[model samples]
Target: MNKLAYALLTCIVILSLSTSCEKDSIRVPVQTIELSASSFTLATDSVRIVVAQLSPNNTTDTNITWTSSNQQVAIVDQSGNVKGISPGTTLISATSPDGKISASCEVDVIKWTLHKGGLGFVEEGINAMALDKEGNIWICGQNVIKLGSQGAWLMNNSNLNPSAITFDNQGFAWIGSGSGLYRYDGSKWEVFTTENSGLKDNSIITLATDNTGRVIASHFNRESLLGTGASEFDGNSWKYYSSANGLVYDNVISMAIDKSGVRWFVTTNGISSFDGEKWKSYGASNVGVAHIGLVHSVAVDSNNNKWFGTNSGLIKFDGTKWESFTNQNSGMIGGSVTAIAFDNNKNLWVATGAGLAHFDGVKWKVFDRYNHPVQDIRTILTTPDGKIYIGTGLGLLIASLRD
Candidate 1:
């Protein structure tokens, strides 16, 4: 009886020991954990899925909780779903129930690209232009158009007849309302008319500002009591220009101020330049203008080279010689130059009645109906981001500068 009982007890103890060993092996901790992606790159405001793999090929508590070092840069959820919040780098980690086992992934978030869109509510042509300090360009025609993030916004469709609109250094918006000049002082409108304020005439053709913060406005066809051409407002006082100020023409159409603070006026007769106190004249008989009449607009380049848009052709005056570029000589596909602007790269862009043309100082690029998008390129404005805004009789065309 002792020998059989002893053998049976020994067998039972051995079976219990073997069972204990199997349970101990099943309770072993995970050696290491890894993520499906060691490093992840995603665009801002986008999301991606990730997974954590545990070692030993076992499903013993395979579920993992995810976290991010920087929630503003990137965010992760319990299911290992990662989302990019902004442009930055963050470390995303997956942790088990115990702090001893964890896996990490580097997440990089990139910036969102700017989308270029169109602004197309104007059934009529866009004629006037005004640029603000915030890099916003406003257009005026039958409607008032403003640039928005999505596209062009037609702020006001009624015809205020904004022949000109400008922002003074003091941030006052001056809008020409045909019979009177309206100034928007943040919220209220202050009207300045010939009968009320010191304005020379009721019709304000164009307004210009100098580097010295002097605002000068020209009358389309008004005679001043002082016998001058344009009215100058020094924020407090007003003055006029005419024969008394050495100005030969009183019918001023356009004006431009150079970087050197010299203001130039273009009239039907010719051009006149003023530097605060001194004045100079350049008529059709002048050497710089070269008897060329019908100048529509004038612009000064970064190098102080004067460019004139004329009905016949484009003229450039480098203080000494006169250079002419017409449809006959250059690659300009349009006639009747209307507007002129320069891009960030210093490329001169011109809008004409027929098409648009660009000159890179050596080569000329002409855009017409054959290969270009705009036909009647009336007013051309180049944005700081290299987008070209062409306001035509039909609608607006935005061209990317990257192309």
Candidate 2:
């Protein structure tokens, strides 16, 4: 490039032609057409990238031509803006009006078609999502991932089968996997298992962080057939609870913390509420739990009302009465509810076996795979940045909760 610049300068000096035949007339050197980059590799999300940078700091010619060898692969405008059209390679050439001193850039476009993005992170079997202290999103699949604005990195916990994820009040992240409960304090990870911590069992299926920063986890205990209850950590010690300690069932799938600081656990038998001192059990007769065999998830709204997802339908209890919303009365396309989450706008996002349902307190909107990318959404979460993260059976997804 330097040699080319010197040659252009020599040509400019050897030329005796001037713009105007007048005394003390200034001469403009030949615009040395040089490109900043010789090649580029971009994604569908990065179509609006600069293809090349022209040299000759002072070139008043607005007629520089930018052309692509294959417009189907990529297209370049006169301003040197390159837009990737497909998953292929193309050569973008820039030429002067006189057809001299030309340069070219090879562009390769890649497509990253995931849930709701063009490219960034791609994974399968995503189930849970949580936010870190820096606002980065952590998604759970076969392992855990810390997804940020820059990109995504997996926090491999020895390939632990992560089932749930949550963030504590102190900005620490807790992951519940089949192996154990792991906590990440940004720098290091602390593992809690039956052999290490106060965990009654090693198969962690669900995790919940209370207002007091208590990390509560549910044990799956499916293989061993010995998981008797759930475990709780007060940032110092571990506590276990089961039928012997007031739970009606030992197979707990999900948990939630209400406004009154009560921890609710969704079990196969019923719902268990713990106030750090006492434990209360509610069944289908009192809490309006239907004949659903399995309770999938649990959540609490801003008003402290408890929400439960079951195979039959969605149940909501505002501390007094339990209301059951199914296909008969609500817009739930599928009767089996898998997960539920509340947005900043007080809207309830529900994931069922058939589609995704949104309730803004007045109406219901359903999004299925036929129209949207939603399919078998397993879990849902809304962050303060107004981004709704949904994990389907396929992979992780991001959607807008905007009306």
> Who wins the TM-score comparison?
2
Model 2, position 194, has a per-residue lDDT of: 87
User: How accurate locally, in lDDT, is each candidate?
Assistant: 0.73, 0.76
- Tens-digit lDDT string for candidate 1 (1-403): 6999999999999999999998867754566788897775565566788888888676465666789999988898888888878766789998876667898988766542322223554355666677777677777676556666666775543456677777888777777656767776656767788898788887787888766568888876444432236888887889888766677687677788888888888776777888888988875666654435766788889999988888877888887888888888887756578888898889999988776677889866655553354566667777777677776665666664332
Could you tell me every candidate's TM-score relative to the true structure? Answer: 0.64, 0.68
User: Runs in model 1 with CA error above 4 Å?
Assistant: 1-123, 150-159, 221-228, 288-291
Best by lDDT: 2
lDDT of 2 by residue, 1-403 (tens): 6999999988886664442344334433346666766765554434444444445655544367888998877787888878766666688888877777678877755443345322333457887888777878888887777888897787873777788899999898888887788888879988888898888888887888876898888887667765557898998898888888898788888898888988898888778898889988888776645644578888998888898888889888898888888989887768888899998889999988777777888767665543345567888878886667878777776664221
Residue 114, candidate 1: alpha-carbon lDDT: 24
Candidate 2 TM-score versus the reference: 0.68
Query: How many Å off is the CA of 307 in candidate 1?
Result: 0.7
Alpha-carbon runs more than 4 Å astray in model 2: 1-122, 225-227, 401-403
Q: How far is each candidate from the true structure, as Cα RMSD in Å?
A: 16.9, 18.0
Among residues 3 or more apart in sequence or in different chains, the pairs in candidate 2 whose N, CA or C atoms overlap within 3 Å are none
